[model samples]
Target: MQYQAPVDDMMFLVKDVFSLTERLGDIADFADFDEDLYAAILEEAGKFATGVLQPINRSGDEEGCQYNDGVVTTPKGFKEAYQAYVEGGWQSITADPNYGGQGLPKALHVLIEEMFYSANTSFCLYGSLTGGATQLLQAHADEATKQKYLPNLISGQWSGSMCLTEAHAGSDLGLLKTKAEPNDDGSYSLEGSKIFITGGEHDMAENIIHLVLARLPDAPAGPKGISLFLVPKFMVNDDGSLGERNGIECGSIEHKMGIKASSTCVMNMDDAKGWLIGPPHQGLRCMFTMMNLERLSIGIQGIGLGEMAFQQADAYARDRLQGRANDGEAPAALIKHGDVQRMLNTMESFNKAGRALGVWLGSYLDETFHSKDQSKVKTADIMSAWLTPIAKAYFTDAGYETCTIGQQVFGGHGYVREWGMEQHVRDCRIAQIYEGTNGIQALDLIGRKLIGSKGEYLKVFLSEVNSDLVTMPDSAHKNQVSELLTELEQLSETIISRSASNSEIPQLVACDYLHYVALVTYSYLWLKMEVAAQGKLDQQSAFFFKRILTRTLGLKASIESEL
Candidate 1:
């Protein structure tokens, strides 16, 4: 299967659907970006994603990454593909201009990212994780560290990895056993092991920067004692050249279900020289900066794979002819069948809605980080805090569902290894599992986001949705969108009230609550998308009717019954 970047759809969402250029025109940082520049950047990125990286997606999945001794080798073409990514400056698209980056808007970055993920999920991780580390260093690392490390990562000269999980600790970072001992020269020496560390060791970049989580000897117990450390695989000399290999080593890489070309290593750190990035005993909070971004990236990854799978299935359905149509036409294409239409429609709906939501959130991130308006910035922060988990879980869940549907479109061929649909289904499954499981996301939604703040954040979000509803002209879709918002508010009240006494009610209903919220939010976007379309009818009505809005009643029943 050949992968083509859906630049038109993305451009539609960027220029027309979102009107991002007009919205950001007042922000000095973003004022210079025009449609022509956005198009040129997107065109080049599409070329790299489609022409360079995508060609190796299937081949890389088949060959996987090789591990010999402690060294990890990516698939044959991955290193070169990544090098091209660096040379083209794709890795630094949204990086700070002070550090060799183009300083582009993150919304544009998200669009380019989808192409990378859709074209090749495994190859995208090497840069994505590095970008996460670079973002963290830019935010918290001292001027010295920033000057030394940020440029390399921003330039893609060296890749970056975050080491947080240990054998004993997965989601619960407070229980991690990694130890960090303070040295005389104001650095820390970390000694412990980390598991499931993505890009922990790879042959693509010159050096690997590991942003690790460890506890100082005198540090208190639990998450409060945790501190983040900058541990590099190879130490840097005073002259900015590579020094001796550091204590960190890749013990082995896991044989995984998918994304095999990306290295997931068991990292052993023995007296690894590490420097503290943020304040002591604040590792978890510091990591959250990266964590929040990763959640969004992973969500985009989900949609990207979904988008890819949909393309493959659509192509296969249109080309592959088999049974007769219901109208007695012989040898009809699979696309003519109603069931096939349903499947394709469902996937397309997910892709459009998912892309819109991701870009919307990315725009908010731009506001949160760059905008001068304090009120807007505060609202963006809270909105991001509540929606991060939802975006993380909902997008991944949608991705997995869409991929499976695409696979099913192939019937027997989907089960076989003939096409790329099966691989997408497998690769997308991990998004929901890692970066905190979807279940964890649900827990966060109800426990922390809903219950912790006494529903103030949820109320703020509801008001935001309500504000959007006012501009939308009166129609069934608009009415339904309003009603769903109210119903969700009432349902949230029920969950909050019931959980006050039952305690287990939140857990029992968190997943459903998450889904209910996801449907409502997505429908809100569909309404805006409709407005963006000037109320014209198209395939989007298919998704709005069946996939999202129609589910409102059933969700109401489920949520109320749970309460």
Candidate 2:
């Protein structure tokens, strides 16, 4: 199936539903961007996604990446496509202008990102990590370090990767054994091996700047003692030219279940000369800056793949002739079947609402980063922290489900490689696993964001929801969502209270609570979209209210039962 960017729906969410332009107009950084500019940027991005990226997706997957000694080679056309991406200035969209970046709003960048992921997830992964790493360095790296690295990274001449995981440690960062010894010249020599490092040793860029987490010789134990370092693939001369290769080498690449085109490597660092990113024993804190951004991007991965899957399924359902309908004498297309319609509606509802939710979160990210008002920045920061896990876990969870439903729409054909639905399923699966597993995200939502804050995050979220509810005209959908919100508030209090006595309660109910919150969140977005559409998306809205929103009832029941 062909991949087309949902530029129209994205535009609707950005302009009509979210009103991002007016919201961000007060910020000096975003004053130049209007609806027209957003559309033009998205249009060109859509073309690149559809034309350059999508074409090589299947071939790239089929060819996969080739590993030879310490070097890893991407599949055919991958290099050219990456070069085109860099030349198009796609990498600079949301970076700082001083470092050769476009300095666009994250609200706008999110939409373009969705298009890239939707077009070709594997192809897009190589660049997505770079974006995350760029943000991390911007927020945490020192001035001199930024001057030496930020420009090349932002311009896409070089790419970046986050090196955190090891063979023994996954989500538990404290268990990591990567060692960093201080040198006489003030630099650190990192000696550790990182596994499952995406774009770790790819041939796409001139240099790969690795943000590695390791321990100092005299550092304390556990996560607190961890520190972040910037380890480049090749040593750079003072004139900004590439010099000798660094001590880091790709021991081997993982033969992954999916995203075969993107290199997932096991990097062995042997006395790799590095510079610390943030303060000592504060690596995890600094890394969260990058991890949080990557979580959002990973959430988009789910949205993008689901969009692609839905398009393929919807197109196939409309064209493929099958059994007869009750009213029709002739054999009807699969779309005529009630069951097929149900599946398609489910996929469409999630995809559209998921996109809207992503943009909604993007708005908060914009405020957190660019807003001058401290109050707005603080609230945005809280909201972003609370919602990041949901965005990562729920979007990907829903995305995986949507892909499966899309595959089911094709019946047996979806299982094969010819239709491309199965590939989407495989590709999207990793989003949930990596960037911290969905389970880990659920734990974070329940433990740190909700309970740790003494329900402050939840209160902030509900306040925002209630404020929006006041503006929406009276309707059953609105009332239902409001009722759900009230129930969620009560449920949250109960969970918090119970957690004080029984620590196991939160862990047991975290996943369900996440789903419950996500369902309600999607319902709220759907309600807003219904109002914003002025009857344009009535059918889709009705489907969400009638069929999709009902899932929350069971999720709530599960949570209550657990409590």
Candidate 3:
């Protein structure tokens, strides 16, 4: 079966819930953006996805990536297709315009990402990593560094990688052994081995620009001592031409269960030529600038996979002939059976909630970037920070389950290789593990976000939701809204209060707490979406609206059961 982009739902969320085109400030660069252009962009993105990228997703997975000696080769067609993506201007959508980027709002890019991710996750990772690496450099790198690297990265002429993890130092950066020594020329010589570096050694571009994390001499112990450096695979001249090899080599690439098309290489940096980003001993802080972007981007990845899985399952259920309906109307496809319909309905609604949350977070980031109002910007910042971990962990966690349920719709065929449903499950499984394992994300949420600064962030989130609930008028959603708000508030208070006494309390309940927040957040967004859809409901829109409300109501039961 072919994949179809959920255009109507995506546009509705962007236009109504996000208002990206309508509410963007008078930022000089964004002044020309309008609804029609935004729609056209999304339409073209969908076409590129369905026509160009989706056709190769399964093949990429089947072929995976290959390594000969130290050189890595992506699956057949990846290099050419990636070049096409670059020519299409996708690599620069949200990058700095001064560096050959289009400088568009991230909300628009969010739609593009969903399609790109859905079309081919492994392929999209190469481009996404470059965008993320470029964001880090643009924000923190020096003039010489930026002048040399940014344009190529933004143009996708060269790709990029983040070298953060070692075999022993995955999340605990304080334990890392990569070293950087100062040279007379004010540059650094970096020597280290990094594991699980996505896009580290692929031959998809002219060069691979690596943003590596290393500890300098005489630095303090622990994470405070770590610093970031721009270490390219090949040295570049003043005119941005390629020079000699920079001593960074792919020792080997990982054999992974999913996203096999994207090389996860073990990189060895032996006295590599490097330039530092940001101040000494403040690398982690600068790294967060890129990580925060990638974290949310990863969440969107999970949401996209879920959306695609739901689409695939819904299409399969509609066409696959199976048992008779419980109502005894007639023998029909699996979709006509009540149990199967319930599962598809559940999958559909969950994907909607995930998309709404994902896009809403994207909207929040857009507002954070463009809003002139300080209070709004600050509010958006706090919300974005507080919700970042939840968004990444919960969405991915749910995405795994959603994909599994999607495969269930295909039964035996789903378990087999040819069907491609299993690929969604395999690719999505790693999201929960990487980007700081979901457990780490949960710990960060409750430890740093919820209880940090004496529960200030959680208070801000709950308070805002509470305030929103008051304006919800006397519709059928009112009671549901009020109940959900109350439940979430109680959970927040319970976790916050208990975590104060025991250090382990937060960790113990964090996964559950994350689920609680996600369920409630979806409930809240469902209320908002239903309200938005009312004024603009066409035939299909009305049906979708009703389904969203039903799903929101059903979630109350699921969440309550967890409690």
lDDT of 2 by residue, 1-563 (tens): 66888889989988999999998888898988899999999999999999999999999999999999899999999999999999999999999988889989898888899999988898888788999999999999888888999999998999999999999988899999999999998899999899999999988899999999999998898998999999999988888899998999999999988999999999999989999888999999999999999999999999999999999999999999998987884679999899999999999998998888889899999899989999999999999999999999999999999999999999999999999888899999999999999999999999999999999999999999999899999999999999999998999999999999999998899999999999999999999999999998888899999998888889888888978
Tell me the whole-model lDDT of each prediction, alpha carbons only: 0.88, 0.92, 0.81
Q: How would the candidate models be sorted by lDDT, starting from the highest?
A: 2, 1, 3
Q: Candidate 3's residue-wise lDDT over 1-563, tens digit each?
A: 77788787888887876576655755556888887788888898998888889888998898989999999988888888988898998898988788898888887787788788888888888888888899888879888788889999999999999889999977998999999999999889999899999999987899999999999998899999999998888889887789999989999999998999989999998889898899999999999877888887787778788888888888888888786777774558888887777667667666777777777777677667767778878877888888889888987888888889899999999999888899999999998988788888888887888778567887777777778777665665557667766766676676667666766777667776677677667767777777778755333333444554444445445434533
**Superior candidate under TM-score, 1 versus 2:** 2
Candidate 3 segments whose C-alpha is farther than 4 A from its true place: 26-28, 466-472, 535-563
Better of 1 and 3 by TM-score: 1
Candidate 1 local Cα displacement, residue 283, angstroms: 0.7
Q: Which stretches of candidate 2 lie over 4 Å from their true place?
A: none
Q: Predicted candidate 3: what Cα RMSD to the true structure? A: 2.9
Q: Give the Cα-based TM-score of candidate 3 against the true structure.
A: 0.94
CA lDDT, candidate 3, residue 160: 91
Better of 1 and 2 by lDDT: 2
TM-score, per-candidate, Cα-based = 0.98, 0.99, 0.94
- Give the per-residue lDDT of model 1 (tens digit) for 1-563: 77788888788888987888986776778988898898888888888888998999889999998999999999989888888888988889888888898888888898898999999999998888988898889888989999888888999999999899999888999899999999999999999999999999989999999999999988888989999999999998767899999999999999999999889999999889999989999988989889889988999999999999999999999999989989888799999898898889888887888898888888888888788999988888888888889889999999999999998999989988878778998899999998899999999999999999889989989988898789777888788878888888888887888889899888888888888888889888887888777746455764666665677677668767867
